[model samples]
Target: MSNIESLLPHLGEDDRANFMKAVGSIGAAFAARTTIEADPQVIAALPQVRDHVLSGGGVELDMSAALDALKEEPSISNQLIAAEVKVAEVSKIQSDTANMSRIEKMNYARERGLDRPRDDVASTMTMNEHAAVLAGLSPVQRMNYARRHGLV
Candidate 1:
């Protein structure tokens, strides 16, 4: 606040009020975005969400808190932009292409394996299949099963 205040007189012909308003708005949005991202579940869900962000589609999120934030510190743009970035994270049906550069979009496309089927069950035995089959076992039970199958 002091920094902005010091600059206000030097802004000269610039609208000081508008400058303050813009600064406050940016602050609010960053705060709100930080709040939403603190949850481990949200972080865990991101890979899927990035798909939506990559595609230029909207994700429905509750923005009432963000709206109320403008009354205090930051602007709505950061909140919205942050949300769009989040949106691209989870939904396989979408991606946040609007916010991405062409190079980034192309990189995403390349890394996403456009040719691979989304559901690819292996025709051969895989470690992932072992994990799924073993998921319900207690440690002792898993050991017993492994020994029984000559897999220990």
Candidate 2:
């Protein structure tokens, strides 16, 4: 409400259609960013996207400036501002996890067969860290690993 009031002065009186397009653009941009960032594999590749959005510029979903470029009525402008807030809220929801205790989190994971044993050393590796560990092993060590894991 207040955001719309603040930005209304920048819009032209006849820009209702452009305001709608800007709002839609802002929403589509946000949804696209969210989709890209959701994938752990792609996340590492998009440093520009990660640095810009994940680090800071995400909430800068700039519909304010978008609307400011267009001309719109006060009523439509208000609705557009409200839509921008809705876009920002999706990112907020992603950052927040349900307030669960560690035990509860473990239980939740266990229920879904996703919990790792607390003492499992390999569970903590990043990406191909295990491959590096395996590469470092001696022939004797490799044979032992295969025997211990019942792979031989």
Per candidate, the number of residue pairs that clash is 24, 2
- What are the lDDT scores of the predictions, listed in order? 0.46, 0.45
Give the 10-residue window scoring lowest on summed lDDT in candidate 1: 39-48
Q: Estimate the TM-score of every prediction.
A: 0.20, 0.21
**Residues 1-152 of candidate 2: C-alpha lDDT, one tens digit per residue:** 12332343565553433333344564455345333112222222222322223323434444444333231435435656766787787555434426777787667666754444334443555436655766889989976754444344
Runs off by more than 4 Å, candidate 2: 5-13, 36-152
Whole-model alpha-carbon lDDT for candidate 2: 0.45
Q: Candidate 2: give its CA RMSD in angstroms.
A: 16.7
Winning model by lDDT: 1
lDDT of 1 by residue, 3-97 (tens): 33444466544345444333344344545655532322222123222222222224432234433433233343465566777666656424455
